[model samples]
Every structure is written in C-alpha cells, then in structure tokens.
Target: MLTAVMQCVFRILPAVWVLLACLGGASAQDYEAGFKAFQAGNYAQARGIWRPLADAGDAQAQYGLGVMYERGAGAIAADLGRAAHWYARAVGQGHPSAQNNLGLMFAQGRGVQRAPVRATKLWQSAAEAGHLMAQYNLGLAYYRGEGLERDNKTALRWFRRAARSGLPDGQYAMGQMYRLGVVVAQDNAKALAWYRRAAAQGHGKAESLAQALADDGWEAAKLDVPATGDAKVEASPVVPKQQAVGRASPDGSVRSAERSSPAGSGTTGSGQGVRADAARIWLGSLRTRAKARQHWRDMLRRFPEALRGASPSYSEVDLGDNGTFYRVLAVGYPHPEAAGRACQTLRAREPSAFCKVMAGGN
Candidate 1:
C-alpha cells in the first residue's frame, strides 16, 4: 500500500507542475492581450481582460488597469484613487514603465500631490533603464528645468542617447542644440550633420534645414568666379589691380578687369583680395552643396523605404544672393541622379536655374 501511494504521488507531481505552468502562461497571455487591446484603443476590452489579472498580481495588468481606471473605461468611472492604488502596486514591483507613469501622476497632481522632485527621480529611474521615449522626456525635463534642475549638458547627453536610439524627436532636439550651440561649441557643419541625420528619419524641420543649407551652398558655388589657370598663385585668390583678377561668369566664360593702383600703391592687393574672398566664399558655398547632397544620399540610403516614391518637397530656399529667395523648380524624378539630370537640363535652358534634390521628392 505504501509503494502504491508513492507511485500515485509521483504520477500526480508532473500533472501539478503542468497545471502551474499553464496558469502562468495563461496569465502572461492575458496581460499581453489586454495591453494590445489598450494600445489598439479598445479601452473596454483592455479593462475587462486586465482587471482580474491585475488583482491577481500581474504588474503589467495592474498598470493597464490603472490606466483604464484613470481614463474611465469599460463602464468603470474615472477613479484617480483606484488608478493610484494599482499604479503604486506596479511601481512597488519595480516596473519601470509603471514608475514612469506614476511619476507623471505625482508630477501633475492627477492622483497624488504635486511633487516635482519625486517625479524627477521616478522619470530618471525609468530613463536609466533604457526606456527610449522616457529618456527623451527626461532629457526635455532637464532641458527645461521642469521637475528637475536645468542642466544643458545633462539634457544634451540624454538627447544624444535617445537620438542614437532612433528617436526622431530626440534626433531633432539634438540637431537644434548643435545648431544653436547650446551647452556645446557652435558648429554649423555638425548642426547640419545632425539635421541631415534627423531629416533622413523623416523629421520635417531637420529636412527643411538640411535643404536650406544645400540650396545656400549651390548658389554660392554658382557665384564663385574661378581665376585664370595660367595666373600666378598669389598665396590667395587676391590679385593686384595692376595684375588683373579674372572672374568667371555663370556661362563658364572668364573676364579680367583692371582698376587704378591704391593711393599708397605699396603692394596693396586689398581690392584683389576682396574679389578672391568672394570667390572663396562662393567655392565654400558649393562645397556646402556637395555636403548637402551627401547628407541627402546618406539619409536616403539609410531609409530607402521612407524615400521610395515619396513626393519631393522644397520649402523656402535662401540662396543668400539678394534675400532668402527660393528658386522653385519642378522635379519629376524619384532617384537623386534623375533629379540631378533634370537640373542639368534646366540649367541648359536657364543658366541661373540650378537644381538641388529635396527630401520626400519623387
């Protein structure tokens, strides 16, 4: 009888273990289904599915139920009290998302007293756990000194982290910081680089900035007057009035001019230097255009799916000639080369009409 009893107990042990496993799996499935429903905007379904599991100690379910209660879903009236209770439960369980959500409640006094310091701690906790959006929001909090001390360096560091994590807002924010030289050395090249990176990821403002930079560069290149190849290199583009400084036209033709020698005439190449400076500036602008093209190409290659067949759009183009005037040109190509060829064709028709590919253009 003892042997038989032992055998039965051994046989039932596996069954008991299987039952426990099934229950655990069912609980997980329930939480996931509820979470999905909530994400899909089905609040009633979310509440109905999550309430039981939440009561049974599923942290995710608890958080979902808390949100539902706070929002008043599934015939459940809005109850900040209940929301706070469930949120506290999840938060106590070390759920980062729950902590972040609860922190917002405290920060805004929705279900608790307003406590900025406490809220900042919770947000930082979540942010430190690699919650990307939370990292971005924490970065903003630090940037604006809301619920925390204003620290531009800390803000920039967080923003960069989020940007590297592929958050568009973070990328755009980092680009703006670089552009404005806030808490870092001002670098137009770096600013443009960040903008290009963000714009490639479909950040509208970044795209506009990158396009503007490219347009400015292209116009500057067009205005540059290349000197004569045979002219002596005077260490710079400056040429003395007596020697004559050659200028190039948009038509690729060169012209030379002469002016009276300076009053002192002691090798005063200031006039020549001014012309050379203009030429250098123009060349520098063209290089900017090249950089812009490279930026666009890099962005396109990174997200081919985003740019595929997308309409090419251009905003205000500041060529820096007279005013910020945009040279509007219609492009009918999806690929960059096609648009470039089209621009060349337009140049053939109108020498001043230069084309630069804009993001989201077909």
Candidate 2:
C-alpha cells in the first residue's frame, strides 16, 4: 500500500515562503535537502525537517507523519497506535491520501480494532471524496459484504467509480465480476476490457485473467507499463503462520524444513512453506456464499472448468482435539476420488491444505 505523503518542505521557512521565494530558492532548497536524505535512507533527518511542520498542522506534513509511523521510518518501531493517530489527524483535515490510509488501516486492523463495519464507513467517506484507493477498497468491501449486507448492485456501482479512477484492483475485480455475472449480466467483452485496463497497470491478477480470456479466443491488446519512479510507498508487514503442536514430519523435504525451525514455532517458512501458507490462508478465508463465489471466479481465471459454473458443496469439519477450536473446509466433488486427489495436490504444494472429508450431500 502507498503511504499518505512523501514530499518534504523547509521546516524553518513559513508556508508563504514558497509564494514569495523564487522556485530555485527556498522551496527548491528545502525539497532537495529532504529528498537527498530520503534517497540515502536517512529517514531520521527527513523526519526532523517534516515533523515540526506536520505538528504545526500542515496537511501534507500530517500525511508525511502518518507514513513515517506506518512504515516505522526514522528508527521508530512499527506502532499501529501512532499510525492511526496521524492518519486520523490528516483525514480530519480533508487529506485524500490520509483518508485512503485510514481506510486501509481500519480494514486490516493495523493500529485499530478490527472492524470491517468501520472500515466500510471510512472507505465510503474517502471514496465519496474521490480518493482512488478508497474507491477500490470500498468496492471490495461492498462486494464481500464486509461490515455491510451484501449488495452486488452497489458493489458494481463502486467498482465503476474505482475503474474510472484508474485503480488496478478495481479494474481486476470488475473484470472478474463481469465475467461471472455476479452483479450484472455476463459479458466477456466487458470483462476483457477491464482485465486489459488492470493488466496495463501491471497488476498480476489482471494479467493472468487477461491471458485466460485470450485463451478462450478473445484478442486483447497488450499495454506498455511505465516504470515506477523512486517514490517510497509504505510496505505492509507479512503475517506469520503459527505451528501446529504434536505434528511430526517423518522425513523428506518436509523434515529438513522443519529442522530449520525449533519446533516450527514462527512464520519463517522456507520458500516452499510460504507458498503453502498462502494457499491455506486463501482457502480458509473463503467460507461464506459470497467468498466462495469470489473464490470460484478467481479459480476460473486459472482453471476455468474447475467448478463448471456450479457451486461446490462445502462443509465445516472439526480439526481440533480436546475441545480446541479448529475447522477446515471440505469441498465436495462428483467423484469421492476427485476430492481426495485435489486434497493431495494442494497438500503437496501447500502442506496445510488438509481437510477431513465428509459425505458430499451436506
């Protein structure tokens, strides 16, 4: 995710200095100093100049403070509390970038309580104010019914707003929705159009979807993606996986990987392990009708015939022993052996994709 603000100005000079001073004088001088420090990764010096201005209620400065807190720049530890504080301060003053950051933090519970409902509100506020990232996130929240009732029509509406704003996530999502007829009538041409737009922005998911559409005999134009400049965007932290107790790796690549971790207590997964965890998280998050449908659409971009446009039978199965809380998804297939095969393939690729099978009808 991109941070709220990145530019810097002179802390000693008054705000009006830029208006009176020559372009190559005070304004340029201050900017160059800060820019050099930022380029050299001297976030401390950059912050020294920016913090006072931010504290003095400069919207851009407030935004810069939010980014610094979020990224833990200038030798600061990552503190969600500080990040939220600065973001709220900037958003309150009508900074679009700050509004977008606040919405993202609310959605992910970075420095605030996890409230998809509140996140929906913030995203709506920002989207209405014409923030592009907010528009994309708002569309996603609506599509997923996150903190709000599911309304495909409204989701499509927000998606249109985001697409018009040239947000890649919105374009990718809209393409998927159009291809599957989730909110509107199914239209391959429209789906292809949106996919192309996102692919032009170098979105990986959109590129894959576009390729899938083209494989079905639809021709789409390739886009020339521009090289991104040296703007420093705040990076999200990676979520680590917890180890399951009492599990033994009998041998092979799995055992060697397990040996790397003392009892596999943390999320430091080897290359193979990371991919497996990603697959598990993806599968685990999809349980409700809406999520399942979205999962199906995503899968279609890769395995178009996997679901055959039919809903898969899914059930919750207990995985915990001694009253511990745990559940895994059991997806039914026409052939019992097919489900078994699917489980094996996923497990081979990602060891955590195991699920206890049940009767298919349920």
Candidate 3:
C-alpha cells in the first residue's frame, strides 16, 4: 500500500508541473494580446482584457490600466484619482513606468497632496531602475533646486546621461547649458552639434538655433550643411568652441523644454567587442533605418546601465515586395539568463518592448 501511494504521488507531480507551465504561457499570451490591442487603439478591449489581470495582481496589467485611466483613452473617462490608485498598485509590484507616472502626479499635486520631496524620491528610484523620463525629471529637479540643493554640475551629469541616450529634450537642454555657460564652459560648436541632433528629431527650438548658427557663418567651415534631397548627412564630431558666455536667456525666463517621447526606432553602438558565438537579446525589427535608429535610442535611454557594455547592432533582411527590414539587437550577453533579466527590467516600463535570446551572429 505504501509503494502504490508513492507511485501515484510521483505520477501526479509531472501533471501538476505541466499545468503550471500552461497557465504561465496563457498569462503571457493574454498580456501580449492586451498590449497589441492598446497599440492598435482599441483601448476598450485592452482595458477589458487587462482589468481582470490587474485585479488579480498582474503588475503590467495594473500599469496599463493606470495609463488608460490617466489618459482617458478609448472608452474610459479621465480620472486622476483612479490613475493614482492603479499606479500605486503597480509601483508596489516594482513597475518602473508606474513609479515614474505616480512621481509626476505627486510633483504636480494632481489627485494627491503636493509633495515635491516625495516626488523627487520616487523619480530617483525610477531613474535608477532605468526609466528615461524619470532620469530627465530628476535632472530637471537638480537643475532647478526643486526638493533638493542647487547642483548645476550634478544636473549636467544627468542631462548628459539622457542626452547620450538620444533624448531630444536632453540634447536641447545640453545645448542651452553650453550656450549659457552654466556649469560647463560656453562652446558654440558643441551647442550647435547638440542642437543639430535635437533638430533631427523635429525639435522646433533646436532647428531654429541650428539654422541661425549656420546663417551667421559661425563655424561654417567646421559644419556640414546637408543639401536638399540628400538621403543622409553624416554629422562630424562636435568639438566645443570656447567663448564668453551669458548667464541667462535674453527673456530672463526659466529655460524649460518639454519632454519628448522616444521615437519608434533607433540604433546605437557597434557590435565590436562582442564574441560572435555568444547569446544576445533581439529587441525588435523596423521597416525604416530612421525607425531602427529611434528604437535603438529608446532602448539606450531605458536600459543605460544594463546595456552599459552591450552593443546595439542591426542587420538588414529582405522581404520580397514588402521591402527590407532592419532587425535590431543588443549583443554581448554572456548567457540567456542575463538577457532574460534585462528583458524583464525593460518590459516593466515598456510593455511592447520584446526580448528573446539568440546566438550572437544569428
């Protein structure tokens, strides 16, 4: 009787494991379906799918519900109070975007009592967890001495981090900093380079600045002016120009640039030192070079530390009649476990950001 009972227990264990695995896959599929619905502008369907999952303690679904409530997307009415409630739940589960959004609400005193100090702390936490907007917001706080001591140097460091990650606002702010000689020495050339980068992303102010500098013949010989209809203009390295600087803008108004969303695609880094046979995380594929570049920039902004040593590379794949697609990849992960961990962190903030392990060269 003892041997028979032990055999039955062992037989049921494998079945239980299979059931659990199937449940996990089903959950992932449901989440993905909801995300696709959201992206397709079917917010009602997304909310319908996510509501149950969120109530059941799914962090990503909670974050999605928070966003829908905050934005009043689709059939939902805009409700900051409900947004805050869902955001609180998501952040408690370590959702990075939820933390950032809740921090913004606290900073602005929307649906919650005004608490700049608390807001700053939340932003700092999200920034450290690889939320790009939080990093930019924390940089702004440091620059303006909001809920923190004035520290222009520290502000510049954070701004540079965002700028290097290809954030247009950060690039523009860095240009303003260089132009005004705040913390760093005033350098017209460097300012122009940063502005050009920002302008490429459709920043209005940066476009005006770049055009003005070009028209004035200031460092004209050092710059490359793209002719009309050019497919691409390679930007030369930006070398800073030393000159006397002013302390403030002509209008004397506090210089603040609005935050811009990351582009759909962008590319960064060359797969130089990565071993050819190592595993890597495949991020996404885009139809255009511009979009590929935007995606790359977005990934860098969102995963700066995790991808510190990794390289961003792309390979073109031909799809007859549909044109070519650029496959974006983060190369240099030593194993699938490391890639999986980084993917989890990225997906916390960007639900649509896909990650899968692949051999380095493939």
Candidate 4:
C-alpha cells in the first residue's frame, strides 16, 4: 500500500545525507567551518571546535557534537548514549533538527528506551515548529497508527502541509495519496501534478510515476487547481532552515509512511465570495481541529498587543477521501503585498512564517 511505498522510498535515501543536510543553526560561521573540516576528513579539528561551543550551550554545536558521537567520527567512538545526550540538550533549546534526531533515537531505542509514543510527540513538536522532515514523519506515524490513533485524514493534512512547504517526501506522499485514491478522491490530474513536482526534485518513485503518467498522456497542466505560487521573499539558499532528521529503524533502515485503503468521501468546493485580492500571513497548518485552535490561542498569547482586536481564523479545505486540512491564517490585511510585509515582520520571531494570498473561490 501507500505505507509500503513510503517505507521503500525512505530505505533508498541515505541516512547520512539526511543528517548532513539538517546541520544548521544561528552559529553559521562556526557550523560552516566544522562542516568544511568534517567534509575534508579533518574530524578531530571539527570536533575540537564543536565541543567547546557545545559546552557553551550552542544548539548548533551540540547538534554537530551529537552527530560526531553518533557516527564515531573525528576520533570519537560511536556512542549512542553520548549522541542522545547532546541531542537532548539541543532539543531542550527548541532546536528543530535536534528534536527530529532525538525523535529518531527514541523511536529506534538507540541509547534511550524505545517509546514510539514519545517519539511521535517529539515529531509533533518539531513539525508544528516548521520542521519539514518531522512534519512528514508525523504524518507517517498517524497513517500507521504507530504511536497515535489511525487517522488517515489527519495524516493527509500533515502530508499536505509538508508538501506545501516544498519537501520532496511530502510531495511524493501527496502524489501517492491522490494516485491511489487513499483518503482523498482519486484525481489523476492532481496526482500527476504532485508526482511531477516531486520528480523534479529527484524523488525516484515520483519520477517513475510521473513518467508513467506521461506515457499514458497525462498532463500536469490540466489539473483543476494550480500549484501555490513561489514565495516573494528570497531566503538565503546556503543556510539550512528548520531541517529534519528522518526516522530510522534498529537495522539502520529509515522508516516512512505508506498508503493502502481506497478513496473515502468528502466535499470539494471553492471559497465563497471572499475577496481574491486580500491576503493573510499563514502561521502554520495543523492536522487536528483541536491543535489548530490551540495554535491560534498560542499565537494570541504570544502577540497580544498586535492581535488585541484581531482574531485568528482558519479555512477547512476538503480533499476528498475524508481528508480535511485547516490552514491557520492571521488575517486583517488590505492586500497581498501588505500581508507579505507583515509576514516578514512575523518572521523576525517565527522563522517559519510566510504569506499566502487567498484566491477567489473555495
């Protein structure tokens, strides 16, 4: 099923690549230096710089140190205990990457007690904080009911969130969901669009599926809904932002979600007469209704003065297959540009913040 396919895709990707890609933090210079040293086979030097910074409570340094310990790199012995230790320290500081890795360790029982529930909790925390990989992992967990209730609707919501954030795994999962008619209604056009998007990013199965669709005369441009527009703000390409360390099994195989069931039922419609010219800053998307409400409450608590008279709002989008998604929007903007500027201001504190202009119909 879908879960099996996801598991296979995870197995194909190298765990080391996920770790290396997720290495990021505010200490850009130090992290870059260490990364260069490690890349050049100067493990000892890399560790030397990272250890002292890690001791000083630098999250990035702690994460680097944890990686070193986990892999036995730079003269350090492979010590899962020490790896977990540093990871925990970083996680305490709300480090997204650390949360993801620590979740993996907990899931695999590496130096820590095996607790799928705890692992899922950690993934949820990181995913809500805008960690792409954690979002995908959390979706998988919900799909498999590994540590949480079996909720394909919730799983699909999480997957859509990750896909919207431009994660290839999420895009591939969405493609699978649409292709197989798993929670949402089967829409070959949407499936092909998602597959093509993922394939463009080098996802192997997505590439194969997209090619197969093409061979059958399917065209992505024929999809009913257009893909979301690219962000106007140009983020720095070199800096990794909120990266995710994927889940791994005891045998070192990475674990991912799959899909199996047939398409379910749901309504599909467009926004009513809401002004298409208006826009809002999208804080995040949540899989559950309760969580989305809680997120709005938290946003109010965090920015009381700015949101004193304003209230957070959300739109539920139905994606056939009994799947529904809640998009948490901070509305009250005159135009898309205004919302975009407001999003930039929000990003000063919430790095994952972005703006989404509302289209006319729902």
Instruction: Give lDDT: candidate 3, residue 298.
Output: 77
Q: Using lDDT as the measure, name the better of candidate 1 and candidate 2.
A: 1
Deviation of model 1 at 248, angstroms: 50
Q: Largest TM-score belongs to which candidate?
A: 4
What's the C-alpha lDDT at position 280 in model 1? 9
- Higher-scoring candidate on TM-score, 2 or 4: 4
Give per-residue CA lDDT, model 3, range 1-362, as digits (tens): 42222112110000000000012567778877776565444778878898998899987778778767765665678688998898899889876667777776776676789687887887788767765556666777777666788687887887776566555556777777776677888887777777766555445677688678766664412223221012222111110111011122332222222221111111123435555437676666566777777878877887664455678888775422224567677877765555544553444334334454566677
Model 2 lDDT tens row, 1-362: 01001001000000000000012555446644553454334667866766675576655556655666665644755566887887788778876556666766665566798677877787677668765556655665665566798676887788776665555556677777777777578877677767766554445667677778877877543223211110111111110111111111221001111111111111122334222212221233222455445544554353322223223433332211111111223342434333433432332222222122233442
Tell me model 2's lDDT, rounded to 2 decimals.
Answer: 0.46
In every candidate, how many clashes are there?
6, 0, 10, 12
lDDT of 4 by residue, 172-234 (tens): 888888888879998777788887655433356787887788778776643442232222111
Q: Which regions in candidate 2 have their CA more than 4 angstroms from the true location?
A: 1-36, 219-362
lDDT of each: 0.47, 0.46, 0.57, 0.60
- What's the TM-score of each model vs. the native? 0.50, 0.52, 0.57, 0.59
**After TM-score superposition, what is the CA distance of residue 62 in candidate 2 from its true location, in Å?**
1.4
Task: Give the candidate order by descending lDDT.
Answer: 4, 3, 1, 2
Worst window of 10 by summed lDDT in candidate 3: 11-20
In candidate 3, list every pair of residues with a backbone clash.
265-291, 265-293, 265-294, 265-295, 266-292, 266-293, 266-294, 266-295, 266-296, 267-293
Model 1 Cα lDDT, one tens digit per residue, 68-109: 666564455778778888878987877665666666666556
Q: lDDT, candidate 3, residue 95? A: 67
